[model samples]
Target: MNKVKLAEGVYYVGAVDWNLRDFHGYNTPGGVTYNAYLIVDEKVCLIDNVKAPFAGELIERISEIIDPAKIDYVVTNHVEPDHSGSLPVIMAKAPNAKVVLTEQGKSGIMKHYQTNYDFMIVKEGDVLALGRNKLHFLPLPMVHWPDSMATYLDGEQILFSNDAFGQHVCSSMRFDDEVDIDQVIYEAAKYYANILMPFGKLITKALGKTGQLPVRMIAPSHGVVWRKYIPQILAKYEEWSSGLTKDKVIIVYDTMWGSTDQMARRILDGVAAAGVTAKLYKMSVSTRSEIIAEILEAKAILIGSSTINNGMLPTVGGLLLYLKGLRPMNKLGAGFGAYGWGGGAQQNMEELLKAAGVAVQPGLAIKWVPDAAELDRCFQFGLEFGKSVLAANK
Candidate 1:
């Protein structure tokens, strides 16, 4: 709520993730924020705009910091609506301001707004002079989208890092040092796992390019600014981008009569017997987005379902479909299910998980309920699954 100056003339004019309810139908287990920045130089610049609802507040912030008319340039690092939804409104206020972006970025803006505004297109490494400061644009395609780019402000030594190196957190203070480091890191990893895991390799390449630049401040579009802890956050990004993970197991399941849930608990018992960290989540009550976020941190993902008319449970099927499309990185998987008459839901889930890039183990299915022997078998399978996950991490 308060504007804190990070550098002499540069302030964090972004909103915090306060009470943001949901993200893409996924429950925000941790609330999210849409971050925007304002850079004050001889030619005043705004790096990305906030969400539509916060447009008026952002305009007020700009007015408080400097004369709105003095804003000479607007930088669009990403064309995603959450980052650029207020672009039209902001441009209307700063009538003389020139919108700056990459060629793809420019196209994206045109597509989103359907207006042919005069714009300046910069390629990777292209520089624009702003009196004492120089802004360099780096093209980062598919780090989430094709129209994304990162900006480096010369002399200030800050990187306007769009959505990379960002987290979904809300706090009164705006810097990484201001927030609890452990909490920030956890949310950051969860953010990456849900939003950026598909682009891990591209993130690594982007980080490599960023490493070559002189960056003292790392400002992103979604969370706290990284000023003093730049190196530490960058290191964490490199580690996450490297496909690194922990030896943990996630059992995701959906059941009609609690049969599959019983099996899931038995599997956890087996996993604990094997000396592994295992977490259980019900697909009916748990959001798939949160499960995917946890899956990003896990070495193994175990799925279970109940058959409905010879097909997998609807929710489990839907989740598997989503997972297959996301192509999350670095995990093994196993599947199980309970069926009444005739079904291969567990096998179907296993095939889908394997198609989604998970190294799967042999799945187990049961007729009605798991007898003591079957439960014991499920436990043993859980132990084997845990061992498989640990082995993969090695």
Candidate 2:
């Protein structure tokens, strides 16, 4: 628990959990923070709510500073349960609180919670006065969700970014100036890759429109608030929003015996020799979501599977199907594997990649056991593919 005074009466009251591990199945190596702010002015307003389990902690923090009943407004920055799961309980305590949100946000809340509460529907540029401070609503639908909107506090120069520019990172420090920069950036990238990668175009457009606004602090729904390095994060978002990726290769495979795994390792070695970053993930244990995140970031993806009953391995087949549906852009794809009786999985993966509009490289297939000669050929093929990807990018 921590509080940061942005303006005379405006404060950021949020819970930081440096020990958080699992966030909706996506790994949070750096932990996460649930941020909520309180504006104590002529008409008190609370911006966002912590998770339900932490509701008592939030109430205690507010009670220590001011009475909860005195709160006149509750700003539902997002209707997602992580931020709004505790709303019912909080509103029960502050009965006079009017929930401030957009029309879409109101509909989302009712749909998710099955409650009809009084809501003040706001559009872009709409302003609400809180005596000394002013709240301006900016509608940013599909920045990630249809109901997502941001509130900018005029006097404090803080933009209450609901989920945009946020990371699932927990830290004792409340601002970027006080936290480790590299850790925050890595977590931020993971968050974007997992959560916001699909909305790249919308994010680009939103950033362009919001770039003109004067923002001194970025108070996101999750993670520490951005105080000094707002531009740094904004620039990163802009770069990621462009859907640009580095020259890298990912070899994903599932093996019946050790043959397929051996082929994957050779390909990885070739990729490294070609001066590209390469990563390996076995489909047997890796989650599809994690692979999708990597797929969204990598320049080239190599898929491999042993043929089971003249078809691709079940896990690899499912991944190929998932990748096809995602329709990742600007990707060079290839396949590799080993088979005993009938070798077809490698060819099948290549066809799937082609069907999904990926630039397919000539796939490599080997017998049950790849001899030294076959391994050398596969490695050379991988090297050629890596160079081709870099040349294409150039």
Candidate 3:
């Protein structure tokens, strides 16, 4: 993509990854974008860079606006390879430019790249003057990464947030208003659920620190820029960071011999009967990342796994492990499973849920394939769980 001007002097010089399907384990079928910004002023500045393979594309976009050699400052918001993999190449082109990043960012860059470069370490509330424009730095440690930080362009009222308000979406449209609002919000929630869920407290702290800034535009390091819907995205981040959830239930299960699957369907039916929105996902068929996204806003999560060798199915175990790492908060959950002889899957899942900070309730463990009576019991379990979810929401 070519450089598109965001403001009078700020331009988006980034690359879109339309073919990317997976990001670290998160299923990103919609692809993603590596957003970098070029600020043209008395002292030209470049905020963030694209992935290593897209470095050439990033430079090509910048060349359309100004000679890369003219850039005086290159700001590294986060040292994650997706945003900083092309740092060496850009710095090589802009030889005279100084590298400005957080002190932690400095250590990370050196450890990752093992290269020496002119560095200007910055901290929270530090300001850098770019002639008429000023860049205010906000240190956001553990907001996904220890080295992560955001840059606020005082003149344009733009927050160059790296990964904080981003989505893993690749679109020809650059701004939030130009694309489908539902798709944007879904992708944003998915990103937050997968990458930022573990850092809820840190995110809350970051939001509080930058809450007073006059942010009219949010130029994240990925996906579309937020100009018209800044408040909408901010509100979402606030809600998510606070561990707020809706009256929704998610049922994730992995079945063997179709026994557990039968239980899952009946439970889902009961949840619906209780006037609650419930989504069912089979772990072997559905993407865990997508399930995690659903769990983000869901008040209840029900996991089912058929026992195998005195343990839960591999797919269910893997999903629970991934979910545990993401650390979803403020959720009520339970487990259910079918076993031929030994029953341990329900207890295992409940333990995992508790480890993930989810409030665990008594789970059901059925012997072998469930009969009509057992299915009825499953339905009752779902009804009780759904009602409890509704009560918690109220």
Best by lDDT: 3
Query: In model 3, what are the clashing residue pairs, if there are any?
Result: none
lDDT of 3: 0.92
All candidates: TM-score:
0.95, 0.91, 0.98
- Candidate 2, residues 1-394, lDDT tens digits: the string is 3556766787877677677778876777677788899899898999999888888888987877689989898999788888887788878889888899888899989998788877888988789999988999888887777888889888878899989888888776778889888878766777777677767888888887678779989989888788888889998888788867789888899999889999899988888889888999998988766677677768999999988888899999988876775566678999889999887897789988887668997888898899999989878988888898789789
How accurate locally, in lDDT, is each candidate? 0.84, 0.84, 0.92
lDDT string for model 1 (237-313, tens) is 88778877788898999998877888999999989887889999998888877788788767888999998877788
Backbone N/Cα/C clashes per model: 0, 0, 0
Error of 1 at 244 (Å): 1.5
Model 3 agreement with the true structure over 246-324: per-residue lDDT tens digits:
9999999998899999999999999998999999999989998899999999999999999888789999999899889
Clashing residue pairs, backbone N/CA/C < 3 A, model 1? none
How many pairs of residues collide in model 3? Answer: 0
Q: Using TM-score as the measure, which candidate wins?
A: 3
Clashing pairs in 2: none
Q: Model 1 segments beyond 4 Å from truth?
A: none
Candidate 2 TM-score, C-alpha based = 0.91
